[model samples]
Target chain A: MATATGTARTPAPAAPERPDRPGPRAWLSAVWPSALVLLAVLVLWELAAVAFGVSQFVLATPSAIAAETWASRELLLAAAWVTTQEIVYGFAISIAVGVLLAVLIARFHWLDRALYPLVVLFQVVPKVALAPIFILWFGYGLTPKLLLVVVIAFFPITLNMLVGLKSIDSDLLLLMRSVGATRNQILLRVQVPTSLPYLFAGLRIAITLAVIGAVVAEFAGASDGLGYLIQFASTQLDTPLMFSALILVSLLGLALYYGMSLVEIALARRFPHIRADVR
Target chain B: MQSRQISAEGVRMRFGSGSAAQTVLDDLDLTIRPGGFVTLLGPSGCGKSTLLKILGGILEPTSGRVLIGGRPVRDAVGDRQIGLVPQRPALLPWKTALENAGLLRQIATGARGRTETAQAAERALALVGLADARGKLPHQLSGGMAQRVSIARALAMDPAILLMDEPFGALDAITRDEMNEKLAEIWAATGKTIVFVTHSISEAIFLSDTVHVMGADPGRVVETLDIELARPRTREVFADPLFASYSGRLRSLLEPKAAV
Candidate 1:
């Protein structure tokens, strides 16, 4: 806050008084209770498998799953790499294409009317249903898998970017016009920067979708990858291996999601307004 | 002293068409002299903003013409001897205070060097008493600070004519008075012709060399009153007899014609 006076201006005091005093360490400490609960649940899961004498074919013990994961570490690591490559490439393509489409749609009302429904239609239809069609068209190769990833990831990016681009405060636009700013200047300086946070939000959602799309495409038809490993384990009745593969898939998704969140945080540091409503 | 004269003749503005057509201003005429601080005082829908837009050459009148320095305003482009401060602060949230102020130079001169632009921006911010806040983003600023940054941006453009549309209307009473004094000082120093639009009678008396009272329902200028107050007017002037007289006259003009 700034206080204005007749002769001078004084900067407002920095300290803000509040009743609830949650320090930085206190905030981090709050997460410990949730972690403890998750640990307890995992313990119960392992105990339950042992107490019921559940067959290894149906329910794998945590130790058994860990052992299997360690045994086939190389294969699992290779598949993880392949899936990461596909996700990275597909996610990059999706962001580029989504932003381009959003800019076009936002710039031209007629284009929006023509293409917006198609985008919604594509998004609503299950990507799993399209995986088979993608395989049929492109065959069992990286192309089909990458295409599936792009398809699944593009919608949220497009919708978020479109909404962000169109969500400009009209008064700001008028101000720019009054300043005699060119169209290009307004777009680059105001519109694009304003939409960045929304774009990053879309990126975070799209990253998880990227992993799912890759796995689904592999499930539909693929010779290698985590999806193939899961399928191989299911056929052999190696439930521990199947559980290990599932865990690897979840970890990969978490990594990518957190990676995007880190980028968003970095950008927000540069542009503080990027912080959402909570701030 | 740099000054620019503005003339708007037989101006008419209409929105939409046919049954949906709404006429905002009809056959309006006004002239602002060089080196003058003129305030447009009106009720809510008096087309003061529309007239400002027309004067700035952002919008052409549906009919008639606007002239800046005896020349048709349509020929003007880019900076065009005009600077505008909208009712809202309208600062770029992504840019810091310094960067936002420097944007005027960037837009006008196509200067890309950061150091030079930063220097100029710092000077403008210092003028507005925001030098310490140069690194702060718009969200980090209070409403008054954001508004001050907006003014600094316009001032940095150094246009011969300044057009402000109720720029301080959003501030609190104390902040508004403070801003008025700062604006008066700046105007005194720069001697740039200013046309300000406001709904407040006291604000008009406090800041303007002359006040133009306008009426709504096909917005038109109803009267103009001259304020012969001395230079470097302080906040105390708000309680002066001349200020009261000018405000009382404006109140009378606005009251009887008031709708409902």
Candidate 2:
């Protein structure tokens, strides 16, 4: 709440003096070692490939992969874009549905008791085995890919949200009740804010799985996407192109993962008390 | 605002039924006058906290009834006549001390805008000598200060009765002593009925107009002693011979129970 003082109302603590920036010492201590190790690995691979005179089709060198990546940049970019769209859409839908389901499950004990087991059962069944069923249901379009991602991503989000809702301190609830807080008030001010950290924990895990889910669906059957490119390249013995596609897929996954982290960081900053781990 | 008289008659609280039944409070009876400061001083498991909850309408007694201002406690609670403070401050971590203090006003009317709550909270914080720490979060507060913020929260509600369950129990010796003085002052200033619970004899004698000593094993009130100490009680009062006598009497009452 904004007080008589003019400072803006924020759910979090006062911001730290300097955020999102590391000092030179921190950069040196954390970043340089990893960079040097990556350089060494690339150099070793290039040297070994040259010494063995290995065919690029059998095992593409780092240089060969880089060259192929540059030569087929447009194709790789388009595939990355398609895959990224699938993961983003699937993950977004999962958040909405998962949170809604969690709220309903937490509010009604009978619903939770009756449906929670079935939900867990669904989560446990190998999602990969359901790819064919999803394809049959939604056809070989973006719909199946989205459904697959939602299936994989939704569980953690729902489970974590349920835990968070139920984890409120009983004394706090009692206090709210004593003050005649309506049910909605208790949920908005107490349950939701208290559950933010847990929600973020689930999101961090769900987003990575979403990427994998999209790829798995594409691998099963797809007309476009990095997964399809991988399949097409290997069949034609285009080892360098296959390696490039694989690299692009991993890079896309990393980008999505980091993007989620940035969102989490922004949330953590707004509500510092929600996360003790925030620096 | 006028304070309300609270009466608990034959209040019995049972946890379970049949073979698993456990009667925590058996036929407890008490009366607290309007604007009076009363402390339920007892050991752990004595159901003092339970009794406080019953008075605050957070828990229903298995039998008997509680009334505040000649109305049922449940009805009174809905009217926002009772305010409760638990052992832990339990302030929302996302909110600052001032925001936590203002929470009662926000909930009382289901008001979305917090301007009025903020003004009321500011006054309450000032009453508790926490005006300087309003913007700090619960984690930024010391044990004593956090507890004070809970008190401010309760005070902001402007309830006729304040129900506190061991609000200062977690504080250290020095802070507890300081808090006792502050609470006594606030009680005098506000003239609101306060039902405070604690296990400390000196604390009870130091703050309350009357102390109700309770015993466990089917919790019930054993004795009620009136403290005739003058207003604005000070260190000199603690050193008074009457203070020692009261302390000695309470200790003797608790000693045999402690052995069991």
**Residue pairs clashing, model 1:** none
Tens-place lDDT digits, model 2, residues B1-260: 44378999999999988999988999998999999999999989999999999999888999999988888998888877788889998888767889889987788866664777788899999999988888876766788989999999988877888999999888899999999999989998988899999999999999999999998888999999999888899878889999999999999987754354
Q: First chain TM-score in every candidate?
A: 0.87, 0.89
Task: Flag regions of model 2 displaced more than 4 Å.
Answer: A1-25, A52-55, A277-279, B1-3, B112-115, B257-260
Give the Å shift of residue A82 in candidate 1. Answer: 2.0
lDDT of 2 by residue, A47-92 (tens): 9999999888898999989989999999999999999999999999
DockQ for candidate 1, please give it: 0.27
For candidate 1, lDDT tens digit of each residue in A194-276? 88878887888888889999999999998889988899889999899899899999998998887887677566655655667
TM-score of 2: 0.93
